[model samples]
Target chain A: MRIYIYRRFERFWHWMQALLVMLLMLTGFEVHGSYTFFGYENAVHYHQIFAIAYLILVVFAIFWHLVTGEWRQYLPTLQNIRAQLDYYLFGIFRNAPHPTRKTALSKLNPLQRIVYFGFKVLVIPVMGLSGILYLFYRYPQQYETLPFGFVGIKSIAYWHTAGAFVLVAFLIAHLYLITTGTTIFSNLKAMITGYEEVTDHHPTSDSQKQEEVVI
Target chain B: MKRIFLGLLLLGIFAAILIPSLFKEPYRPPLLSQLREKYHKKASKSADHSKFLPLQKPFTRPQEVTEACISCHNQRHIEVMKSSHWNWERLEYVTGKGIRAIGKKNILNNFCIGIASNEAACNKCHIGFGFKDASFDFQNPLNVDCLSCHDLSNTYLKASGGAGMPDPSVNLNIVAQSVGRPTRNNCGTCHFFGGGGNNVKHGDLEMALFDTEREIDVHMGTDGVDLSCVDCHTAKNHQMLGKVYSLSSMNRDRVQCEQCHTDKPHQQTILNRHGIKVACQTCHIPTYAKVNPTKMEWDWSTAGNLKNGEPYEEKDSLGMVAYTSLKGTFTWARNVKPEYLWFNGTATHVLLGEPINPTQVVKINELFGSYRDPEAKIIPVKIHRAVQPYDKKYNYLVQPKTYSVTKGDSGFWNDFDWQKAIQAGMQHLGLPYSGDYGFVKTEMTWPINHMVAPKSQALSCVECHSRENSRLAALTDFYLPARDRNYWIDHIGKGLIIFTIIAVILHTLLRIYHSTKNQARRDV
Candidate 1:
């Protein structure tokens, strides 16, 4: 049976962020002198534009998550996380049952919760702060008055580039994980239509018991 | 959820519409035109120089004109005597070498070498009555030739070999009566023709700057603001506000563009930030030697060649002096792009009697700066290279007597004898010169600060930002984006990306194979 899981704002935020991040990477790598697609000046110009768009999307996403109490979906938990890892590594090939189930209230499995929480708390903040510093490092009026001194742009640029690589690797893995659901295109369609096909288990089953424990 | 999505959609729409307008180019004020208007009124002089009775008197000797000028302006002679123009040296605190008097008199250059024993010929540009030898008195105020820079009639010409005296053909009375503030013509007479010819020493400075279109130079162009040399090089107590690094070793007395155009002149903050590390001339002066060809290379080893025991000269296809027995073989070029270097307005010169490595190309004067120096900026320069004589045994540069008044003398220009010329030149300076002599390659750098092109012709960002033939490719001290990248990071980062993609493909294929097997078993 299909049930509505992703809200309208959640799907919108997800797709918008994906598009913006892809554009940032395309222009950012060109700016780094890695094979040029857009010219250097145009790349810098567009990179700044997309970066602002991404920041805006992030702000809206943060507000929506907090106001709707949807932030609890990503709270890290160690329960069944090892089973989820084993399921992806070997159990998926044997058609074994999933360690965790998806629902309207608890959308993220234990492993997904930990990964998303770490990304939100660590990676995004680093990329955002470093990107802002890179944009305004040469702003003359603010340069002298800044509390912290920067000898050069070398360290900031390296950190931003490293974060970009991490984001790209995460994207590759995320894209592959979407296909590991009940069907090849089930999760993709669920994100788009907000309806995921979940198995109807008995109310007092072990999975339900585990879901109660998680909640 | 639907209401929140709609709100975000509206916000995104507003941002998309408003962002472009926020970045629209702002109106930039015409600061340059306003500056021109302010300085344009100073052209009209208050006093009519021709009405002075002292200047009207017929002056026979150039010294008599100086005496006539000193009669009215009595204390002005003291300021003139103290200047580098009359003294030809200044007390400069050179780094690593305590206070030393350095100037054109002591400094050696690749072109025309030094003026040790050849003062009679080289002193043609000196603002003095008689600097024929080492015995020329520096204490005498009468010897200061005031008319060389003050003559407005353009008739006060210096004799070619008369030791800085006025030419006999010049009507000194007319020149003295017409004396006014120094114009481009006055400064160009000596500065534009430093190495015995127009634009020979300084590629960016030449006779073309006396009167040119705005395209050649925005400031000195007669059609434009028409600023005189003194407008920027403002003088106080007869000491000018600028010094060439060829003779100067200190960073003081600099004439900066920021004096008028503020450091943050650009409307865009991005462009203004470049001013910190890039000099104005680096972009404005795209090319030097715009109108006339400048000497690029001189080979003294080929100077002794003559046709039938008579000194002769050869001309290149462009009619430039290619070879002259009196001087040397020279290579000339026009519209040449300047090479860039980091400079902090300070330099170290290869002094006289200083030992040099004969095997390597020695820098006559080394410009001191680096990417790490906060005060340093990238500047455009014209490098004049030459192969000149040096003492082989002593491992030091030896001055040669290239010119002499007496015919068939031991000077290099007359008798063409290297041994005798070296001996005479060394004896004049009281420096020991080994009899053994050989030619050594040397380089002299002159900063190109003039012949500034219009704003439209300034260098674009791609010139230095691209990986292909970047202008700043030689300066590898710091990392510049688009032109530089860390090799290890790039390799490792790319490797991980490729590895992730391969693993994803392998895992997906394995899952697909297992699923097909399970589906077949369920159907059976």
Candidate 2:
């Protein structure tokens, strides 16, 4: 039975962030001199545009998460984390059932919650801060007064590049994990349409328990 | 609902990408050129010099003309006498080497060596009368050849090998009467012909800049702004506002681009930021010696090679002197790309009698700065390399007497003998020279400050930002994007990405195989 899981705003934010991150990576790597795609100047220009868009999206998403109390979705828990790891490591090949169940109230598995929490608090913030420093490395003194007193862009650039690599790795793993749902396209469909088909057996009791725990 | 979100996302992406590119960059006013025009108009002299009775008198000697100039403008020679142009040396505070008097008189160069024993010939451009030897009095006001610089007449010529005297053929009275503001012709008389030939020493400064078009030089172009040499090199108390790093040490009196154009001259904020670290000449003067070829190499070791016991000259296909039996072999290049380095406007010169490593290429003058120096900017320079004589035993460069007024003298060109030339030169300077001498490689750098092309010819970002053949490839002290990257991060990052892809593929296959096996079992 299909049930509403991701809200309208949540789905929109997810897709938009995905598109912006992809664009940032494409242009950012080009600016890094990894390869010539958009040309150096154009790549820097587009990268800055995408970065600003992403920052705006982040501000809105942070506000939305706080107001709607969807921030709890990324609150990490140890419950069934070992089982989640086991499921990916050994159980899935043996046709074993998933260790943690997903519901409207507790939408993420223990492992997903931890990974997503870290990605939100750690990886994204690091990327954002380093990128901001890099962008304003040498702003015109006439236009804006920046407090940053960085001697060189060496460390900031390296950290930003390293964060980009990590983000790309996470993206590849996340894309693969989408196929690990009950059906191959189920999670993908869920993200797109704001719904997922949950098995009907004891759904009311499971959701009630999840709601209590989440609250 | 999904379709609406997808369409909106696509539209937003397209708009974001297209909006910036669609709008052209705002037009920036040509403020620099406008300022140049203003200065060019202001450079006009108020007084017609020919009307003065003192200048109209018949003058036989160049010194007599100086006496005539001081007769009216009495105190002007005081300012002229105090200048480095009169003394040919200045007291400079060299880094690590305490306050030392350094200039063309004492400094060693890779080119025609030094002026100690070759003054009679070399002092043809010295801006004084009778600077033939060490005995020339610096205190004499009449010795100051004011007509060399102040002469508006094109006919004022310094006699070759006459020790800075005006040529006898030049009508001194005419030159004296025509004395006014110096033109491109006046400055180019000495500067354009450095190292005994046109465009030989400084590759960027050549005869071509005297009346060239905007393509060759924007500032000195007669058809353009028509600015004289004194426009940028503004003089106060006869001390000009510029320093040649080859002859100067301190950061003072530099004629910066910011003197006319502000530090933030570019339209884009990014380019303005770049201006802090990159000099204007680094981008604007992309290539120098645009018209005439300049000497790149001079090998004095191959000198004394006589063709039928007579010094003969050989020319290349371009008619540039390739070899002369008197001065040895030379290589010339036109439209040469400049090498880049960080300079904070200070320099350290290799003075005479200084010990040098004979095996290594000696830097006659080393420009001081690095990437970490906040005051430093990357500047383009033309490095003139040469193989010149040095004392093999004492390990010091030997100054050779390369010229003489009369034949059969001890000068290198006259006698074609290095021993006699070195002996005469060292004895003149009162320095010890080992009887034995051998040629050692040396280098001298001339900062390219002229022949600025039109704005459109400025180097684009990719020219120095790319991985291969970057103009700043030699300057590897700091990390430059596109030109530099961390090796381990790149390799490991790529490795992890590939490893993750392979693992994902393997995991997917395993899951598929297991699921298919279970389905087959259920069907059976």
The candidate maximizing TM-score is: 2
Q: Is model 1 an incorrect, acceptable, medium or high docking prediction?
A: acceptable
Interface RMSD of each: 3.2, 4.0
Worst 10 residues of 2 chain A by lDDT: A139-148
Model 1 lDDT tens row, B1-524? 56857586658846964776688687566766775687655757778777888878787778888899899889988999899998889999887777889998888788888888898888988989889888999989999998999998988899888889988999988988888888889999999999989999999889999889888998888767778899999999888889888888999999999998889877766678889888999989889999999999999988888899999999997799999997789999999988999998888888888899998999988898888777789999999999999999999998888888676677898888889999998888899987999999999999999888988899977678777778889899876777877777777778888888999999999998998999999999
Residue-level lDDT tens digits of model 2 in B1-524: 54664466556556656776678487667776675667556546678777888878787778888898898889989999889988889999987787899898998888888899889889999989989999999999999999889888788888888899888899988888777877888998889888988999998777877778876788777767777788899999898889798989998999999988898788777788898789999999999889999999999988899978889999997799899988899999998999999998899888888899987999989999888777789999999999999998888998888888667788889789889999999999999987999999999999999989988899988889888888999999988988888888888888888898999999999998998999999999
Off by over 4 Å in 1: A77-99, A138-147, A179-184, A197-215, B1-25, B31-42, B312-319, B507-524
DockQ of 2: 0.41
- List fnat, each candidate: 0.40, 0.44
Residue range A1-215, candidate 2, lDDT tens digits:
77667777788889989998999999988888878898888898878988877876777678768866899889999989999999998999988877876777778999999999999999999999999999889722323445775446888888888889988988999999998987889999999997787764346666656644532
